[model samples]
Target chain A: MEKKDGCVKPSKGVIQTEETKSAAEPVQNGKETQKMLAKVGKPAPDFELSAFFEGGFKNVRLSDHKGKWIVVCFYPGDFTFV
Target chain B: MGVEVVAISTDSRFSHKIWQEEELSKMVDGGVPFPLLSDAGGRVGTVYGVYDEDAGVDIRGRFIIDPDFNIRAMEVLTPEVGRNVSELIRQVKAFQHVVETGEVTPSGWQPGKPTLTPGPDLAGKVWKEWKPEMAFD
Candidate 1:
């Protein structure tokens, strides 16, 4: 992928997980992974995860926020510098 | 501006609580004004293609999902650098403009700036309507 300003490409040495490995595989005989992975211009995969919100833990589902734009960010870990 | 922001990491909720209290609160007035999600085992990250199984963590990434749940933009980068919040907000505004006006935003486009109306007439004549210097201004 081409690197743009304020964005760096993931290292080539990074390991791909099993799910991604299967998803990345070239289609053969018209068979492909049934699971839908998040991609630009495609519907985001839905997920329900626990969250720490307002001094309490709560279950947050992506679909629950339908009809509103959502910005989902992921980081390596907590307590680490941004 | 009606966007819901959430952050996810492999850390547990307890860790998020402590981080918010001990670190984030000091930076922001009352800690980040968004939900700090805990993605155990990187399941959510796996679907987003940002999980690092060997490291047991999700690499730093961000996604802008439209109201319809379609991913309009995504940024994936290593942890060495922090993501730019201004750029993220800019793109969100640009997307919102396109959705409302059916006009395409040019590079570095901002609100009240020139937007191109997509059609055959504006195809090759883009330079006549917008100039490269306009992006910087």
Candidate 2:
């Protein structure tokens, strides 16, 4: 099994109670909505979705690739620029 | 020399078929060494952070990932403009070179060319050996 760091791994069955909801507060929130979303020097989020390939559509999951480079490029709507 | 290029666009398979049959097939006839992927549901775009939520479409985004699945570089171009394939190829080659040898590629660098040694004190060494025609100082 793949092992993750302790900070990212949450213990099982650790559910937040109602009291914890009110205690939690926003640490620091920014209001820059719709900003430049794509960023470099970060982990590219993996995904699996229906894609048309090899003359047919297939479900492609990101985890399907255990160790391989995946260049996921997203273009605008087909047949229309902008 | 072995790299996978996956191109995704928010379009139905039918539309993708039309594009391949009408336009891309011609490019393939000429020379297109890659396959085009159709993101019919736009989910892949959403995960890649390229989805235009209001417009319900994805912008132009390119991601370079290493064999270990770590993203090394990414570029998202404006919708009005297109990306430079030559520069993309150059970057892929440069990254491959760096992975093979501990070297840094200057801007506009090409393969089989000299590279900079990454160090604070070696700036002058890089600058002295740098070629202005490369468009990097």
Q: Which candidate's lDDT is highest?
A: 1
Tell how far residue B48 is off in model 1, in angstroms.
0.3
Count of backbone collisions within predicted model 1:
0
Off by over 4 Å in 1: A1-36
What TM-score fits each model?
0.83, 0.71
Number of clashes in every candidate structure?
Answer: 0, 0
DockQ of each: 0.40, 0.30
> What's model 2's lDDT at A71?
66
lDDT of 1: 0.83
Q: Write the per-residue lDDT of candidate 2 for residues A38-69, one digit (tens) a residue.
A: 34654445554444456654545554553666
RMSD values, in order shown: 10.1, 9.5
The model with the greatest DockQ is 1
